[model samples]
Target: MKPTDTQRLLRRMFDAAIAAAQPALCVPPLLPPAPKGRLVVIGAGKASAAMARAVEQHWPGPLSGLVVTRYGYAVPCERIEIVEAAHPVPDAAGEKAAARLLQTVQGLGADDLVLCLISGGGSALLPLPLPGLTLADLQALNQALLASGASITEMNCVRRHLSAIQGGRLAAACHPARVLNLLLSDVPGDDPIDIASGPTVPDPTTCADALAILRRYRIRVPPTALAWLESGDGESLKPGDLRLPLIDTHFIATPQRALEAAAAVARQAGLHAHILGDAIEGEARDVAKALAGIALQTVRRGQPFQSPCVLLSGGETTVTLKGQGRGGRNVEFLLALAVALRGEPGIHALAGDTDGVDGQEEIAGALIGPDTLDRAWALGLNPRERLDANDGHGFFEALGDAVITGPTLTNVNDFRAIVIDGPPTEAP
Candidate 1:
């Protein structure tokens, strides 16, 4: 039996995310031989636990350590302990887990090896606030940032300043030990330090950058945090830090790889695939509007590409919240796209997070047809109101259009595709 379009699109998204997180797909076989002393595994992110499991499976030497992931993202790992924590927001579990991870890496000698499995969500998963800043302070700042529509880079620049373990501080803690960081990139540009806030990599971002981001967002951070920023006391490890002499980092999976996978799938499905970009960023709604414009151009002019082609993109998009309803960035993007399309014919689209959860919601994302708004109206739902409420989950759920794939155990950020049919047709 042939798969439905939704099924095909979902499978493509899942395949893309997994492909971007796989170890063999990422880890080089010719890594310098393991050090003579103890080998410790440490990490934090939605994909960290799975990455740790992959490492345990392939490593020929004895390894022991711990990694923290969002609740329910854990995979069974005998050698490495997996701790589940909160994401997009920090909790005491995340705090405790981060503390343990810090203690685990300390005091290692030069002969020892520290394998760091870093990925998206680590920024929240490893929320170890610096001196004079409380977890509550960080939490409030995180909430403000989430609703500020700030780009991840901007948000992470702020986080790096507030964190004790991020911006290469974690790697620095294991000074004199050989640190090998294996990452699954979810941030645009694949800057190693930006992925999971660069817990295991040096950060070039400065206190001034963080302060500027806060000012741009008009977020009122704790006075202590501001003072720390002014003091420049939180500066992260720099490129010339002698402690990083033996450190090595590799990006195992990235949005680029995920987009390529989706492109391959689109070709197999008899469609020409044009990848707009793998690192697109900005507000979800604005991005949708821009994407809709391109999609319309493709249909009307056939200048960008011919019909029977799919526009594919992958990256993490941000949603600046103006409403009290629950919504993920992917859903916000889809809702915005639907409104812009204005019930245009022959277009179908899906936008979702690769990790099977969008923002803080359980649903991965949603799908929309040309009739998305019409379907909602027929059901007496107000698409615009829901969009305003940031209620993508509620809106899609009411239409039975929400995509739910629980804990895929990987993360590469967002996956979006727009499929334009051969031509416009009468209303079905």
Candidate 2:
């Protein structure tokens, strides 16, 4: 295929993947029956506001509540209040919104219904620190964890224990109300507890587990926080907790579903699509290297599958931030993939976050092809040095290869595709 065709094809697959996970498409069908009593909606994440809007559009009964999403992600919702907050880190707005969410579910009867919309980035958007632990403490802890390369599960375990409303605490607060949780899965494995720290569900992890993760990462906590953990006072509500109300959870969107949607797009273009996995996770560079090896093998021998195929995968990856440059794990993965490919013929790749933001930047991710390294060399850019500095954003942006999709209003983790072609036929 031509270079422009390759880029366009890859982007089409990405758009399809994101469309499959949109709240409007995923939420309405799964909404529960209208309750006899009040229906209160509460949520937190990059997708929660949109999910709340979906609820408002579908529900037949009167429903009113609140949801907090990352800034620039809010959609129009009439009954349910949509609040914007900082994501990947907690802020004052998120703290206030979280407190209000807990109160919104209070004083409810068993007949009342609580619709909890949860998704990726919810952990940071619902930062109601446990008693004696301040929001600043959560902020510093989140910063450390982001840089520590801790898995999403580990980071959320700590978040669940340290927060007043995470884990099953929010559900417990709605003692007599029935909670119908609609979750958008962005973490690997689609574990409910890891999605927004499982605010409306029970936590299977313990305070001891959170403490161990903190120590494993060498992350120090406030003295008060430490004392609280040691005292077991910050322990999250666990399974079989009697205080929790009647709760039903559903995953409206997941990585596997998104990958399948992307795969369908590739197949429609007469390319064989293979879904490698949906829950792959590791260091960004490490994952890139491994995937590059597979792509090279497919190109050279076609052992796994024939050429003219697209290998697609989805999952969140970590980047241990060591450089002072702009860092996003998706960009980091793409840059590493480019270096590993070393301008191999008939190979093109794209890696991006479905949420339309990679790391702290608005850019989604980037694209790479056989001429990627040569193009960099033409501009006197050292790809290796940029990779070493975790400056994937800078490197790709300079090449004008950065993919920008503003506020996709959804999160199903990362999407990666490697396209390989068959060798050209000799002139007949």
Candidate 3:
């Protein structure tokens, strides 16, 4: 069966994401040859399990450790145990796994080696609440932050302050040991500290900044958390810290690399590809509106790249949930973009999470074409109402346009493509 253009483009995008996240493709062979003492592997993220498996396959020496991944994202490993946990929200399973990981890393000698696999969603997968704070407190704050449309950096900043094993504290616990972090960045800026809340990386955000985030979002943190933030007692590991001297962090996968891969795929498809910044952040709808304006210009005036081109972008987008319907930022962005386009012909678009889930829903994201608005009207669905109710998933699902890939096992972040066919004169 011949695949549609949209299908081909989406497959290319997914392939790019996978290529950028592959552990074997990213892990170095000569990584400070096996230490004389024990080699312990510890990590948490959507991609950590796969990364850990890759490490074991490549390392010449026997290794043992644990890594926590989102449920259904686990890959079989012979030595390193893969634990499944919740994502975008913390659960008791994740909490226990995080506690155990901390215990496993403690008291390592200078001769020992610690390989840490860090990736997106580690913040929630490794949920160890600070002293005097309950898991419920962290859960509540997480829910609030997700709904608040806070950027990943802001959310992670708040999480680091409230967690027992985040923000460089994890690395500090492995004192005297050689720590090497293999990171897959899902955050917009690919900041090592922001990914997975920087479990092993030095945190540059301050407690005051975390408190400001809480205030900005009106999130109710625990009294203990509040006091810690107010007192500025729990500072994260800083640069030049003696304990950090032996730690090395390597970014294995990033949004930029993923975008470039997607761009390459577009070029292969005989379409000119333009990659916008890979670190874009803001409210989803606003970003969609801005992108829609640019896309319109490219289609109408031929200003950007010309016809038969695809504008590809990657990063995490935010959505402030005000409605009761299911919605992911990618879908929300598409919905807003569709509304703005108002059925402009000869343009098709796809936006989705590389992890194959969007905003707690099973759908990755949705696709939009020139007929999207018309099709919705035919189905008697009001696109504006759905967008107003934060029902992007619902709207797309009704049209059978929602793409469901079911846990791709890797997460770089949101992948978006705006395909503009030839000018209006080239219409069939």
Candidate 4:
């Protein structure tokens, strides 16, 4: 399909963001030294399979391993087995993979190396429910969390406390073995424990904290899960546990780095690139309002940043569901931005998840320009109503403006770019 200049630029920026975090490029250098005994690799996330492939290419000795990734994100590896599983919800495939991953790490000698490749979506991809908690129980809680507009930090705290593998229990399973955790940061603040719910790192959040967060969101977790948390029976490995001392973690890819990559590309295109933040978190529409305000200021008043500049930011934004429309946080943000901008010229923007899937849909995100709302109105769609309905996916799809990249195989979280071409004469 022929794309407008704005669409082309927006896509270029998104591609650059994803490129910066490719496993082949970022994993080689972060490889921990090989151990004296057998090398057993274990991981979970959308990027773990690719990370496993990178590890297979670099390590000097033979390696045997198992890692689980979101379905359709698996990459081929020589000796490491890549298991495909559901994401954002627990499924039987993930449940089985979790058991196999735990089994793979068992019986590792003190000198053996256990490599854990973790990234976004790992929390749901590794679904080993605590004793007496069914996969359906975890699934219900995950759905509630998704609808609650809870931050990733709060949601992960609950996940860690409820799961058997999450919250460093997997690392603890490798007890005497040395654990090298390679992580890709997708959450705000880049807290290692929050990434994929910290399956390999010591958890600092307590069971009480998880219970409180669930209550704050008004999410009704399974009775068994709630009971375990309240009793501290589902508590994860603490900071000073003996099993965690041999664990070393590395943050290989991050939202900040992805934003910087897009910024570099913008600079090369002869536009001043301003990175507002790499960890801005809030409601999707709320964040869009802020971005639109900044973009309009740059266009009308030349404050914060001059024209012919691109503003970049990255982070996960939550959606508090009030409607039944299929909504992705990125698309919702763009739709809200378009509404607030009132079809302002010289400002174009795009927001997409780096994993190539925005929310639960296969579509990544959508791009918006001066005519976005005009087109929507002409198509008999009410922009404000659609926004309120959380139907950004439908709104953009009708305009034939949705960006679909299938599976990106790696995730660093959301990637956003707001391009302001300045005054009328120089606008692109």
TM per prediction:
0.95, 0.98, 0.96, 0.97
Rank list by lDDT = 2, 4, 3, 1
TM-score of 1: 0.95
lDDT of 3 by residue, 1-428 (tens): 23467666866776676677666677655355888999999999988888888888888887889999999899999999999999888999999999999899888899899999888889999899878888889999899999998998899999998888998888988988989888888888788989899989888789999988889888887788899889987677777777763888788878888888888888888888899888888999999999998888888878766878888888889999998878699999999999999998777889988888899988888888888998899999999999999999999888888888887767888988898886734222
Q: Please report how far candidate 2 places residue 49 from its true position, in Å.
A: 1.3
Each model's lDDT comes to 0.85, 0.92, 0.86, 0.89
Instruction: Give the alpha carbon lDDT tens digit for every residue of 1-428 in model 4.
Output: 36777678778889999999999999999887667898888899999999999999998888899989998999889899989999877799999999998888878789898888999999999888999999999898899999899999999999999999989899889989888889988998899999989988898889999989988888887778878998999999989988764988888999999999998888888899999998989999999999998888778877777889999999899999999899789999999999999999888888899998988999899888888888888889999999999999998999888989888878999989999985633332
Better of 1 and 2 by TM-score: 2
Q: Compared with the true structure, what per-residue lDDT tens digits does model 2 show for residues 304-365?
A: 77879999999889999999889999999999999999988999999999999999899999
- The C-alpha stretches of model 1 lying farther than 4 A from their native spots are 1-14, 17-20, 23-32, 423-428
Superposing all C-alpha atoms, what RMSD in Å does each candidate have to the true structure?
2.8, 2.2, 2.2, 1.9
Worst 10 residues of 2 by lDDT: 419-428
Clashing pairs in 4: none
